[model samples]
Target: MSSGVEADIALDAAVVLSLGMNRVLGRTAGLAGRGAEALAALAAGRAEARAAALAEAESYDQALRQVLERNARIEALAETREKLDAEVALPEPLRPEEQPIEELTAWCAATDQALDGAERRLSERLAAQVAAEIFAVPGGAEGLRADLGAPAPEPTENETYANETYRTLERVLARLLPDATADDRTAVAEAARLLAGIGSPEEAEGVITEVRLRVGEANRRTEELRARERRRAAERDAAEQAEAERQYVLGSITSAFEEMGYEVQDGFETLTAGEEGAVVLSRGSWPDHSVRLRVDDAAQVRAAMVRTAPARSEDDRRLDVEREREWCEAFEAARERLGEAGVRSEVTWRLAPGVRELPVSDGARQTGTRSAQRERSREREK
Candidate 1:
């Protein structure tokens, strides 16, 4: 139960919780977060513009209403005048100043002109107002709720609802209490969940906070109990990585042996570790020349096999085979040319499934012999 291990476990739990929350937030917000962020930088200037547009729109609407009211009044007055013409007796036209029809017609025309101008201004103002509203949607934290496509996180009831709340509360509690055992944390989570769904947020927060503290304490205690487990797990992982790296190194060495025609078997005979599952595989015939091979545990080997596929692509494999064949071909050509220098040599170029070797049987000319004209060709072919 070391402190380092406990700290690592707590940190791991925190990382896991953070990743999950990030994904949840990402899914809920879409790209509105970017827009929300952009709005804040320009809010001050934009707020003034928005206010001006809104004020202009209200002024226009008021103007429009006033024009309509005035027009209605004029029309009503005209109707009254018409009724008066029919109901009351009027003298025959005689005085030059008593030109009622002309005056009434002129008054109607002037009111109509004013009404038209007011209506046009109102229309323009409404368009500006619409633009302002679009530009002035609440942003930052306010925008977050809109961006979530959520209903502002209302509390709920019912078993299913409560369960969801419990899970959410559990996550928060887990973040708050990284060291607690899973079971103890779950208990705290359930209590917090119940509190979340109850009526009144003030009361809910008060109740949940207590449960959260209790959960945190339990989580911390559980962490202490599991300290040994965490330490052992870390050690196991370190050992595995070290072992994997060593196995790769050995494979590299075997590759060098195989190039010299030694028929290197790599893990074929368990040459290095000499643990269980080691084999006595022989390559050369009769009074055989053999190389011992050893390897990590089979579980480690299998995991490596499954994981190593991604290190190469089909195209890479194809190119590698082409390159190897060219090398072997040049080596074979070099051996043939070596005989011309009063040097007789026997060389074989070969490749096989799961193995490849090029053995030269020239005892005297073996020194740096693979280097003669080796820059040009190798005989190994697919």
Candidate 2:
């Protein structure tokens, strides 16, 4: 019984030891499984962290590329803006808040407005200059202000201010030089046309200068023509006055000769060689004797003379001498009569080639003898 109890105890002890060893082995296996699970979990976590880091790095690269592109575009726009500013000769167009497109649009709008305003001003200045030039022409300002009917209306959208001003100036110019030459009119018309279509202020100014020069040349020519016309008129007047004076002188001389009972020739002829202002006179009964009057440039009778034929015999010579004496006395009486009529003359007598000059008398010497002789000769002829 002791042995059996001991054996049972020993069996119980071995069983207990086995049970303890199994328990220990089971616990160790459980610890190893748990450690393997822990290690797998740690590796999975590390792989997830690595994937997250790669995704983050890729996102950062994309973001950096975008920033670089944006910076490049901005720099390009800035360079374009600087070039544009230099080209337009204006201030920097782009503001800090303006994008490239916005700044360009604003600049275009401002530039258009400025150009329009400048064109308008230049057009107005040109119009004024053209009007002034027109007014300077001869008879240009004749009632021009009063004749200008009314002001024109404003221009429409289709019409620019320059065109409107040009039209107005054209109207004024059309009426200005009514007597201008065809060439001058054509030149002015051409200049006006050029000025009307001018775009830039510089172009308009250059055209204005050219037009002014043309106008000046045209005016100079006009003035020259006017001077020529005046000279022609003066010449015509002088010629007329001279002709009138000549007619008056002729009439006076004719009247004086007709009052002396002599048949006077209408015009002067060269009776003697190298003699000027020699007038011949005749009577109805005296065929062999003649009378002459000498005149000066001033239409004044300088001298009067009686001429007789040459004697052929002694009796004829005596008669001729007597006739010459009678003629001298008659000439003296004629001189006295002319002096009373406000015409002073010197008496001369000519017999053959001999001439005798006598002083002018204020009173009659002996008119009865010559008068009786002339009366007898007239009665015999009748």
Candidate 3:
């Protein structure tokens, strides 16, 4: 294969790998849409020189893989730190910055164990509080045992065992209640109120059973809800980050053109505003010919040289193969400019110069008439 074709194949492989890795990272760590930045950086390095060797392509692949792996680790650490801050609420906030991966992983494991201990302590405290409230009432203890279908307590040892069992039940209920739905919580609250004012034996008998069942179902529903939310959050973050990166890339393209001495109008919103996507127009390069660039919704940019004024005859409208070849060179230069700014240009298809006799027309209006036409042509080819 030609070197150009080889380089294109290598770049395509890199993109495929990047996309696959991005999906894996999204599933594991909620990190997606980060591969674009790595690809752009790779393009910048490639721009140092277009090396045709297969070895250079292998180097690009290795560099991109390394970038993505390192980026995933860093972002994962940051996200874990934020989550710990929000849920654990440590007395002194953790400073996870600049920490090595091994150190961060160790810290996360240690903190997780500590959080388990803390939750156990809290559960015990809640159980104690419930016990105190129950004993404070005259027949509360007896009523609770009756509610759970346990026999009434005797003296001393049996009574102590009964008290401990009831406290354990309270602790279990408390642990699951946090993950319960609003309706489940309401049911628990109602049961608490009814238990507090138990004037009869029948009422106390079923309250505990009702609470246990409600919380059990609620816990399951809550798990599903949490998973769905996490997925949605990852998707949302990916989309927003993708758009931000695209805008940054678009801005770089605009700047690259401006640096090449072309006038750019920032016509990204042209179609909605009833104009075409004619972002750049050349001046003073050729008396009757000018180069124009149109960017579509997908941010694909096309450059073409056209007549400066309306063609007055059929010959005037005829294609100029020499000019077409010249414009191709200019287009390659534009891609190089984008590479300098750390953007990748993937040329999916191109028409060879002088191969087909196609008529040339007047340049696209900055207000966007012909630019839209070119955009449609590009879409059809795709």
Candidate number with greatest lDDT: 3
Clashes of 3: 1
Query: What is the Cα-based lDDT of residue 316 in candidate 3?
Result: 51
Write down the RMSD of all candidates, one decimal each.
33.4, 62.9, 11.5
Q: Write the per-residue lDDT of candidate 1 for residues 94-133, one digit (tens) a residue.
A: 2122223345345445766754544333323322222233
Lowest lDDT sum, 10 consecutive residues, model 1, at 1-10
- Candidate 1: where are CA atoms >4 Å away? 1-182, 189-213, 221-240, 266-382
Better of 2 and 3 by TM-score: 3
Clashing pairs in 2: none
**Per-residue lDDT over 260-292 for candidate 2, one digit per residue giving the tens place of the 0 to 100 score:** 666776433335443454455666755555555
> All candidates' TM-scores?
0.23, 0.39, 0.54
**Each prediction's Cα lDDT score?**
0.35, 0.43, 0.48
Candidate 3 per-residue lDDT over residues 99-134, each given as its tens digit: 344554555556556555544443334333444454
Top model number, TM-score = 3
Better of 1 and 3 by lDDT: 3
TM-score of 3: 0.54
The list of candidate 2 runs beyond 4 A from truth reads 1-150, 156-160, 164-168, 171-176, 268-279, 289-382
